[model samples]
Target chain A: MSSWEPDSDFVFHMPTKVLYGPGSHREIRAEMADLACDRAVIVTDRGLRENTDLPARIQKALGATCVGVFDDVEPDSRFEIVDAGAAFAAKLGADCLVSVGGGSSMDTTKAISIVMTNGGSIREHLAVHALTGPQTPHIAVPTTAGTGSEVTNVALIKDEAARTKFFVLDNQIFPRTAILDPTLTTGLPAGLTASTAMDAMTHAIEAITSICRNSMSESFAVQAIGMINGAIRRAVEAPEDILARGTLLSAATMAGAAFCNAMVGVVHAVAHALGGVCSVPHGIANSIMLPHAIHFNAVTDAEAYAPVVATLGIKASSPLAAAQMAAARLTELAASCGLQTKLSQVGVNRRQFQEIADKAMADGAVLNNCRPVAGPEEIVALLDAAF
Target chain B: MAVVFPTAEWVAEFKKQIDEKPDYKEGGKGWREGVIVLIINAKPQVGIDADFNIYLDLHEGQCREARVCSDEEVGDHPFVIRGEYDRWKLVVLDQLEPVKAMMQGKLKLTGDLPTIVRNIDGAKTLVKCATYVETVFIDE
Candidate 1:
């Protein structure tokens, strides 16, 4: 094989079976039958359960298969909740897990599967490839357009006692299936719609330029970026536009799949650190740091961003110029969507910058960055720039 | 080159550089973990007859100890990173990120992952300081 094919020797893992489009949630019955799962536990957050009809809709779709509902998952889901979710699922004898809502809900479901099967604190299972053995099957029904948690093998479950977010990455934890229904997202306000799409865009850009990127991952990232660029504005403006929301949903999933293989870079590292350390919403944190990270990577791997520049419709004469244009366009897009462009705008104090930088340097995503980071000092400088 | 990596002189140089470099000190001040053992696997062409361990006790921004020791001597180390000689060479020469190398499976990391993640700057600083050693590579 040609040297251009990095993935020829590499493994590409995409185990999550996706059922997308309008009303795909109805396919849960068939999926359950396919997985030979008789009982399912629906995982969701209280906010989504209270605010949306998603829980009732999911129950109606599941019919007799839905044996239980664990609606206690919080945003940035904690280990205790996952433990409790696992217990609840076990009590109900749930053979399958159904996640409804966004990243937190889906992640909670993933964590539950781990604890249910592994029988330990989630902390013990916090390293790369820490998990082994079969997991109770999971089906994700994403209610938001970001996180792509539906397709990824990463679960960022927070440990409340440690005051740190621990990520669990294992192919075993990937949901067996995902249901993407854009109608569930129409109720998402303009702000959330914008922030989520920005998050998806961050995933795409980071994946596209990630050092571990391959042809397949790049194709997914590029397509995701293009779709997000084309449909984000409409999704935010019209909120109820099924086509636009559908496009953003597809983009988010594609970006998720891309980053799952290619992995993300500094943007995710910083954003994840923000989520862990400061309780910042992942989407907002990603949107705030995305442009600065793009600029940082562009300084060294400017040519890597040609696809992003072209996808964003930025005209430029050189690689650096293209990178700059892409970054500028991203900033403009975020601003137009009323998302905060500065970290300071989102209540992250200057005092916490050093700690956040330290965490970012340690994040798994930092390893996948195209341009090798010197250490926390460089990250602190980046944080300061974003500030 | 000032020293050849995987040698006693290189470990000493690494400790000295960590002490002398203000950036390393500042970046690693929050790292309180102790005892990191670098297990370099055997490479026949490079004169490595057997796998050896480099023990480092990093305490709140200071390298309390840095030395080459036998595998049996790597006692009570909280973090132990094991990898092939070539991968270690790449890391010491600044061609690869230590964390990246671990993720790519070129390096095997065993320790408290959260604390390590929290102290990632220290990890990077440790690797970055090695790059400044002006070391000689056996392959080169």
Candidate 2:
């Protein structure tokens, strides 16, 4: 039986145009033109600027229209970096943005676009539905298979002073186009591939079990889960396999589309808190917490998770058993991928559990958890168990 | 006779229903937040010639007050939800979910989103209260 009732009402919307192929990144000019944007700025990081030729290739593809490159984005994109990037883009007379890296870079571009058009500090527009209409045109070329920031309407910006991250969600911030070029992700290291694929997997699972999930989001989540399950191992072990890489990239976008509408659950809430409190990498935190979160919500969401079990290729006696097995299988899969399976392995301490729990309680994602958490103590217990 | 929506009587009745519901009292226990002002945009075609502001003084699972307020009286409330008259009608009629409507840009919400999101059950209870009111559509 489906989680949604026959008479349940839902609203589904996906506005961004996605171009997926081996070398779709080269279509930057056409994508920009589709939005009637002329001057484009490439928003990325210094690592991609120094190590890879992807930025240059996109610049060349955009030719005269590509005004400049802003590579000031950090690993966890900060508010200051977005402000600086926005100023740089505005100075260059850039009318559009082409983000050319992972989640941080793409999210930076989204924030920069908001600041450029709205003409204020990124902090001013922190509320949901903050923007009245669209912001600057943005084309996201994701070099990592995680985050799926290209399709999501949210940008996670860290506040250095507060030592926590905050979400800026608005439909207008969704990238105008997502260029999923698998070749851009083929050179990722084994650990990154594993961690990022796990991130996508977590997104699919959480979307499936989120209280707000509808048929359309569930369909995408299921498809993404199946694809990631089939391709993640090959994509990680044989990093150069284009087919596996492409599958993971496509699945990540599908997962993004799913969770963007349905929203995620406690896994993301805890992961965001971990990223904020401990400086643990987002994907790594999600990879470590995915199975544990599943276990926590499984009792209440067994029916919703049963499909995830099948998608993960697990066989079980019943829905509840299937949910439990699904959690166990995720642990095994994370271990096989060489991902850190516990918070302790990632340098998180018992003392920090309280702070992490406090932050997680305040997270927007927690609202949609299949199981309602009474207080921070429950999260502390979950963290203790994961530890 | 059905109380005409946007009138002072409708707001009083809505508050009465909210106070009577045990679900609202229980579900809203966590909601110690400040007032929520609903701005119903004018639809002149439907005879609502000017914007209507309904101020809800809600705290700790109780409706302290529900009354009509002027623009100046809205005054620094923690949450403000603005939408077309028709959209608000759909929400009051339980045909549309408020959170989903906000997510879809059909309604504009200005507040700490996480707080509102966390108290979604409370919000739903408030909406249920609206449905209990015997309302007559102004357009009809």
The model with the greatest DockQ is: 2
**Candidate 1: CAPRI quality band:** incorrect
Clashes per candidate (backbone, < 3 Å): 0, 0
Error of 1 at A218 (Å): 0.3
lDDT of 1 by residue, A53-148 (tens): 988899999999999899999998887888889889999989999999989999888888988887776655665554547788999999999899
| Residue A326 lDDT in candidate 1 | 81
Residue lDDT tens for model 2, B99-132: 7688666787877776887687898988988999
**Deviation (Å) of A253 in candidate 2:** 0.6
Best by TM-score: 2
Q: Pick the candidate with the highest lDDT.
A: 2
Here the TM-score of candidate 1's chain B is 0.92
For model 2, the superposed segments whose C-alpha errors exceed 4 Å read A1-4, B15-33, B59-65, B71-78
Find the 10 residues in a row with the least total lDDT in model 2 chain B.
B103-112
Q: Report the lDDT tens digits of candidate 2 across residue range A1-387.
A: 356544766666688999999988778888888899999999999999899888988899999999999998998888999999999999999999999999999888989999999988888767676588889999999999978888999888999888778777888899989999999898898889989989999898888888888889889989998898889899988888999999999999999998998888888999999998998888889988888887788777688786687777778787888888888888888889888899999999999999999889888888778898888999998898899
